[model samples]
Target: VQAGQRLLIEGAAGNVGRKLIQLATAAGVTVVTTSSARDFDQCQRLGSQACYDYQSGFGDQLVRDEWTFDHVIDTSGRVALATNLDLLLLGGEVTLITAPKDDQFTFGVRAFYMAQKRINGFVISHATVDQLARAAEVLNQAFSAGQLLDDQVSQQHFSDAPRCHQWLEDGQDGHQRFVLLPD
Candidate 1:
């Protein structure tokens, strides 16, 4: 995302989404999000310009509010491609960082192509060493500036990985990020 553009982040309360907010906002992009109502305040505190409850038809809310984003970063695979396409402005793009829960999704190829829009599947493992280095530099800078807060992180010993995994898999109540430290 570039300066002076708007970005929409789905699942903004989660780890990746929250980090995206800190980085994007720091880069001068306006950030907005779709997350649980409980996380609205936290999201805003993290620098999101607007927050909508994902459980309450956030797509409809955006439409009603006449909001359109220049780009979107969907960390959760919940929203459909067609729906995200509708929310994008001309030549906008959507990048999905997760493998969706559903095995299949469909969208109008015609409309997608007509608008000059693009869709990308993001995998950090696919990044080159140079790319990773560049990104690390930015993350380090952000961390040094205290832009990446510790309140949202839950640290655990490495031995507790199984328990933490189970808790996360079972959908633990909060959206806090987990960090596994050496035991």
Candidate 2:
């Protein structure tokens, strides 16, 4: 993200969202987030300029607040594609790491193209070597600046590997990064 651009992160309580906030804010981007009310303080600590509860018609709230983003990183698929399409500023993009498994998304192709807005999915493992290198440089810089989100890391014994996997699959404990310690 370029300096002075605005970005929105949905599921700001998630690990990726938190880390993204730190990185985006460090780069001088205006960062806003959507999450549960309980995570507002944590999101703020991560440098989000504002946090809206995703369950509470946050799309409408954003419109009312006159907030539009040049980019959006969606970690959770809770926000439908249509709504996100409407939220973008001209020539904006929405990058999705995850999305609904069973639903088919549709948007007006004409309007999308006319507005110069776009959407795409991202899987870091699938990134090209050059792209990865660029991302690593940024990640290293963030880590050196102490912007890395250590709080999202939770150490667990290797014996708990099964449990950790279950937790991730269940998605019931919210988002966290596992540091599996050797047994």
Candidate 3:
């Protein structure tokens, strides 16, 4: 929430990305978010100072002079590492939740050194008890404030879990999140 700090969040429409936007905005950081063209309006409404369509050749539109971020969070993991590094100012930080080339040791090592960037790798399983408690508290606050009320969850009986997996694998759900219900 440092004044005048520009935070660019990649994958700004998904769950983690959306939460990042809300928290950063609440803390008074100037936030820019990237998503598909269809999700731009949603991201903007959720408190992004600006929303860019990542699929629309907008990455090239962000020249060094036009946009420089103090922090970049790559939630999508689809963007090129070089491009993300170019967007950061000196001594800036970059975080990635996913590494597409994890299996290739040489490529991963080269990519890290080439960026001249401090790269952080993350996995949800790394959340500690304290972190989980804090997340729960935030969710409670959001619910109390009516900001967490949305019909974004689709309930499926346990028997349909296999179908749900198939749907996800087939990319049929889009923004839908499925929840399983025990019969």
Candidate 4:
């Protein structure tokens, strides 16, 4: 992300989304993100230039405002794929970190080709050690710069793993992230 480019991050309250906000902001990119109303403040605190409530139909707002993004990153892959793509500027790219839950996606072939849009599916688990190392180094720099806040994380007993997953799925826990501690 180059300086002055606009980025849209979906699921900006989640773990991956928060990291993306920090990293992008540090790189001087202008970030606009979507999250639940409950986590809006958290997204702002993470350095997002603007945060919208996804549950309130942020896509509609984007359309009304006629805003576009240089790059779009989806951490949850919960939004309609076409809607995200439509908000892209010419030659913009969309990167998906997680597969959509329904395993279905659609797009306009003509629009995609005409705009020169690019789509990428990223699987972190498939990353080589070298790639992981490079990512780790960048994260380490962010940590040293006090951009990574570990204090916001909460620890839970491992037995609560299922409950944690359920909460996450339900969007019941906002702002605070939980880490399951092995018993």
Query: Which pairs of residues have clashing backbones in candidate 2?
Result: none
Q: Residues 39-147, candidate 2, lDDT per residue (tens digit)? A: 9998998799999999999999999999998998889887888788888988999989986553888888888999999888998779999999999998888778777
lDDT by residue (1-183, candidate 4, tens digit) is: 688999999998877888889899989999999987877787888788788888888988987877799999989878888988999999999999988876777789899999999998899889999999999999889888887774467799999989988887896765567878888
Off by over 4 Å in 4: 155-183
> Between prediction 1 and prediction 3, which has the larger lDDT?
1
Q: Kindly give the stretch of ten consecutive residues in candidate 3 with the minimal lDDT sum.
A: 102-111
Q: What TM-score would each prediction reach against the true structure?
A: 0.89, 0.88, 0.79, 0.86
- Between candidates 1 and 2, the one scoring higher on TM-score is 1
Query: Tens-digit lDDT track for model 3 on 40-158?
Result: 88888888977888886656776723887888898987777667777877666778887745333222544446655576777779989998999899878877877645438999999
Q: Ten-residue segment with the worst summed lDDT in candidate 2?
A: 144-153
lDDT tens digits by residue: candidate 1, 49-143: 99998888889999999999899989989988777889998899999999877768788889888989999889999999999999999989988
lDDT of each: 0.88, 0.88, 0.78, 0.87
lDDT value for candidate 4? 0.87
TM-score of 4: 0.86
lDDT of 4 at 18: 85
Between candidates 3 and 4, the one scoring higher on lDDT is 4
Q: Where is model 2 more than 4 Å wrong at Cα? A: 162-176
